[model samples]
Each structure stands twice: as C-alpha cells, then as structure tokens.
Target: MWKITYSIVGYDPVEKEWGVATQSKFLAVGAVVPFAVAGVGAVATQSYANTSYGPEGMEHMSSGKSAQETIDLLTSIDEDRALRQVGMIDGQGNAATYTGEKCYDWAGGITGKHYAVQGNILIAGTVEAMAKTFEETEGTLADRLLASLAAGQQAGGDSRGQQSAALLVVKKAGGYGGFSDRFIDLRVDDHKTPVDELIRIHRIHQLYFSKSKKDRIVPIEEQIAETLDHQLTRLGYKKEDQPLLHTFKDYLHTENFEMRAQEDGFIDLDVLEHMTRS
Candidate 1:
C-alpha cells in the first residue's frame, strides 16, 4: 500500500559521461533508491528498498557487467522472489532497469543512453511519461532530471502523493578544493512540493555555487570597472574613491586594505571584478 517515485542525474567529467536512474517507496526512499560513483556508475533500488541492489549493482557494472546483465543477476539473486525494482547506468553510458514479477499495480522502467527514469505504484502512465520527458528535455543533466520529475507529477506521480525528493550528480574533481565534488546533491526529505522546491534550490545552486563552464567566465576589463564603481556607490562607498581604487595586487600590498574592505562589508576588487564581469 505504498507508492514512490525518484530520479537521479550523474555526470563524470573524466569519462565525459552523464546518466540518470530512479526508483521509490513511501518512506524517505530516494536515500536508498539512488546510488552513484563519480567515475563508475549509478544505481536505483526500490520496490521495498532492496538497498543492497544499489551498491551491488554498481559492483557488477564495475566488474564489466553490461547494464542488462547486472540487472538480471541482481534480480536472480533477490530473496523476496517477487518484489523488487532496480536500474543502473555504467561509465560507458549503458543503461538498464527492472520491475519484479509481482510488484504493485503500475510499476516499470525505461533505460536510455546517459539516463533512466522510473517509478512504482504510480498511475498507469506516469513512469514512461517521466522517461520520455527526461529524454526530450534540454539543458544540463540536472535540468533534464527536474523536467522528468515535473512530467511525472503532471502525469500523476506517486499514487499516494508527494513527500520527499532528491537529486545527486557527481564528476571527477567536482567537489570543493577538488578533494571531493558532488556536482549536485540536494534533497527535500519531506515537503508538499518537493520536486518544485528541489528545482528552486537547483537554480540557486547554478547561479551562485555551481562552477560556470570555462567559456562562461568573462575576463575583467574596463566595463567591469565602471560596474564596480556603480555598485560601490550604491552601497554607500564614496564615489570619489572609485577612481582611487587600486587593483587587487595593489590592495594586497597595502597593510590593511583587505581588513578595511572586510570591515566595510565590501567585496575585494578581484571578486568584484569577477562578479561585475560575470
């Protein structure tokens, strides 16, 4: 008597790959429903949260199992015998998913290059619609995942209604300090419109936290100088000081310029230059 829907989008820059997978249950399901390794693979385990399927599925893929073979092996070994669902995508972008013989009313999945989207106990048409929407949407992997979730909702998602949603994406050197990077990892553990809320947070991440494509960064130039001057004036800095503003190198050489800027709540020239140009 439970219904769940989930989706995941993952990318590995080192391998130049992208993928998606999903499954669900009524509990905080996506936590177990989706698993991903930055440069290895992604998996989704559901239909009563067969959590082992996630890691084990990835293991099979890592060992050179084709996506279909991995799913077949996992299904063959499941103890429940007739209540499980799962999906996977490997570094090569091969994809596969499964729904057991005795799952609830409406449950199944579809796989594709770079992605898979699925749901269980959903309305008759939602799962495939989600997969189709994901396939058709444009933009980053994150955008396509969100679109798929939205489409599922539009087509009557989770027969029981919404509670939680999550997203995870990873790439090599994608984390902070390049020590650990998750391109996108956000969740709404419980919410009325979890998918929409997740989308809002994703937009915020793209605007501020996400690293821009290398081509998107505009070099600091004279146009930015004027913009910085205007911004400083609006923030109550003396307009006269605009011209006297030194380059970042000059500020670094000054004894307390950095501290002064911090105290005044003004961005350093280097940051201002980047922001204004961007």
Candidate 2:
C-alpha cells in the first residue's frame, strides 16, 4: 500500500554533498521518498509518509537548525506524527532519525556521525546493514548512499519486497552545466530489482555527466593515444588532418562524454576506458 520503505540520508564532508538512497515495496517511491538541497541537507520521509517533512526539514536546517532540531520541529506540529518515519543529515554532517511510535511492526531507525538510516515494515536488520555499509563504504556521497541500500536489501529489506528505488545527491555547482545542484538524481520507479536497476543507471549517469577528477586525468600519449586514434577511425574521423586531442574532443562530443572530456592534453581514466570498451 506504499507504506513499506527503508532509506538512508547521508552527508559527505569531503565532497560537501548530501544524498538520500531508498527502496520500497511501492510504485514510484522515488517521487515521495527522497529530498535534498545543496549546502543545506538531505531527508528521507516514509512510513505512513508525511511528505511535507522532507521540505520542512530541509528548510529548517537551512536556517541553522541542527538535524535533530529540524526533525523535532517537523514532527511537533503534525497531528499524525506517530505514523511517520524520517531521517535527516544536515550540511555539517550531523544526522538524526525518527520512527513514529505508531508505525508498523519492525519499524525503527539508527543514526551516527554522518548518516541516518530508518525503515518501517522492514526486517530487524535492515537499518543495521545500512548503517554499517554507509560508514564503511568509501567513495562519493552517491556511492555510499547507494551501497547502503544494497546492504539493506541483503539483510532482508521491506517484508513485501522491492518495487522502486531512488538515489539523489546534491553539491554546490555539481549539476549538468554547473548551473544546478542536482548532481545525481536517478530512480527506478517500478522494477522487480529496483536497487540493481538504480545502480546500473547511476553508472551511466556518471559517465555522461560527472567531470573528471584531477587524479584520474592522464596525459594523451602511448597506448591511450593509439587506442583513441583507432576508435576515432572506426567512427570515420581523419586523425591525420586533426590533432589527436581535437579528434578526441569530437568523439567526446558525439558520445555525450562532453562533461568528462578535458582540453589540457589529458583524458579522464574512466572516459578512456569507455572509449576502448565501446
């Protein structure tokens, strides 16, 4: 009935990003389960699901409220507070989680330094698995958040099974064209294995949108140059007339790897791998 869900809200201090990853036994759970604002916070609202808590919690945190305070304020005025479950992580990485007293059996939550994991109508170890994974997994905020969902599923997730999953992460100037904060917002609205689907799409999303990190950029020479020339010729580019970098740029633009392409005589490692693989 759209009431069974588990989620983790996390903040990555290293990247200054906030994220929410969730899975549920309901259709299109992504639309209602996750929310975040760059330099503000992230929230996951579920259970009987008071949708307003997502925005209201973020709004309160934006005004200098701690994650716990924001949760307190949101649950305070709601007449049906006892039916709601929510987790939040503020910009400073302070986290909090709440499970309403009247929520379904097996509902509860756990919070730590930079993450809050909670669930309703879930198996006993769901939140525990999520918490351990989020703390131990190392990567971008999106990576850790998504791993947490996978771990939760492995530990016996929502009793009724999976239908939808979502992953959302936000950082200042991290979106497409660097004009928005929606760095990664991918969803599996209805799927037999929603978390797996979400992970697959997220890999593609990173390939197409994320910029290359400095450490991963390598000079365009040797085997990389040879490979690029071979791949470009297959695409009908004349490398003799144009420099390898220029020809690679054309290929990057054509393949929608424009965001990860660089002009400093170097190519991102992942982009190079994609070029060779494709």
Candidate 3:
C-alpha cells in the first residue's frame, strides 16, 4: 500500500511530447506511475494505483475523448474511485486531475495550461512546489518534469521518504530507432537519492540519443576541419598515419555521433565540441 507523492504530468506543445515524472516512498514506483502515448496523452496513477488507467485512458484519448471526459467516464464506473488519485493530459494539451477524498493527508493536485501536478502522502507544499517548478523551469518536457520532481523532494516531498522515481515522455518516432513513441523512460527503481540518479541517467540518455540543436550545429568549416584532424590524430585514428576525414568519421561512428555528421562527407560542429568537451 505504499503511496506515491509529488508527480507532474505535462505536455510540450512545441515538441509535441507528453511526459510524466514521479517520486515515491514505494519501491519501484515507476512500475505503477507514469504512462504516456505519442500523439495521445500522458497519465499518472497512484494511491491504490489501478495500472489499467494507463492503457485504458490512452485508449479513451485516442478515441477522441477529452482528459476530463475520460476521467469522468473512468471514475463513473469504478467502485473504488475514492481510493484513487490520477492526472491526465490529452494530445491537444488539455488537462485534468483527481484526488480521492480518502487519499492520505496532504493530497491534492493542480492542472494548468498543458500540465497537471499532483501528490499524496506528501508534505503540505510538495505538490505546489512541483507545480511551481514546472511552470518556471524552461526546457524540454523531460527537463521540466524532472526538475519538478527534484523541487518537490526539496520541499519535503513524501513524508515517508524517497525510494523510487521515474521520468517518461513520448512523441511520434521518439523511441529507439524511430520504432515506437517511448521517447524517454528512465526509472530509479530503488535508490538512496532517486531524483538525483534520475537526473544523471537523463543526461546520459540525451547525450547518446538527442540531436544537438539545429542552430548550434556548426558546419564543417576550415577551422573545424583542422580541429577534427588534430583531435582524430591524437585519438590514435589515422589513415596512412595522416589526417583523413574518413578516419575521423570512423571515430565519430564509435562515439555515436552519426547524427552530427555524415560518415562519407562533412563533419558536424557538435562532433568537434563533443570531442573537446570530453
């Protein structure tokens, strides 16, 4: 019966990404918390989490149901409705939330433009802190969601203490290799400092998977080519013991910079930045 506390479910209209982030005193809270579908919506179910709310709720939104309507329809049929807590946001960024009357003290939620923030069995201001962070923090949906969770924890968070945390976001072709909608799904199932661990993992995820911004991308100019040639030589990749773009490309391939450059052609500025930064 471990209850979760301090979670945010939100949408990024610019990126068309839906995300949910949660922290709890429960072990493996990620298993029962955040759920999202690309071009559909995101949901968070806690306080006697009926995991069914995830898939079933997405089905409702997919069928053209608004978040509030979907919540009403689902709660209308559940005999144990009063024992649940949930938040939802539809594809268009409309939002809704609910906290059962029987939820433990310090339980409630806030819904706003493109987002819902909620918690149960938490400190009095935990959910409020989360909402404030989500609104003030600027970045991708994943970045804001994770910041909200961290803020909640700093605001006292679950009175019972922290054990698990999760961040899940979805968008069209956001999954590995453009296969699915699961853009980012990182969980700290059991950790002494779960929120911190979640942040660390998220950074690593973006490093390997996220493309550098289009504006920040430096084209392979004369100076950049020289940097690459020098760095590749220092890294022990050489063609005929001399500078070659092909050798540099091979190094980029090993470092997962395929997105920043074409193996046969020009180099990306990010590749040089990454090499130097490392």
TM-score of 2: 0.87
lDDT of candidate model 2 versus the reference: 0.89
TM-score per candidate, in order? 0.74, 0.87, 0.84
Q: What global local distance difference test value does model 1 have?
A: 0.64
- Comparing 2 with 3 on TM-score, the higher-scoring candidate is 2
Residues 1-278, model 2: lDDT tens digits: 33799999998888899999999999898899899999999999998888888888878999999999999998999999899999999989999999889999899999998999999989888999999998899888888888999999999999999999999998899887789999888989999999999999999898887667889998888988888788788768656779878887887887888788776688888987776676
Winning candidate number (lDDT): 2
Q: How would you encode candidate 3's per-residue C-alpha lDDT over 184-212 as one tens digit per residue?
A: 99999999999999998998688778776
Least accurate 10 contiguous residues by lDDT in model 1: 256-265
Q: Is candidate 1 or candidate 3 better by TM-score?
A: 3
Each candidate: what lDDT? Answer: 0.64, 0.89, 0.86
Distance (Å) between predicted and true CA of 80, model 1?
1.1
**lDDT value, residue 124 of candidate 2:** 88
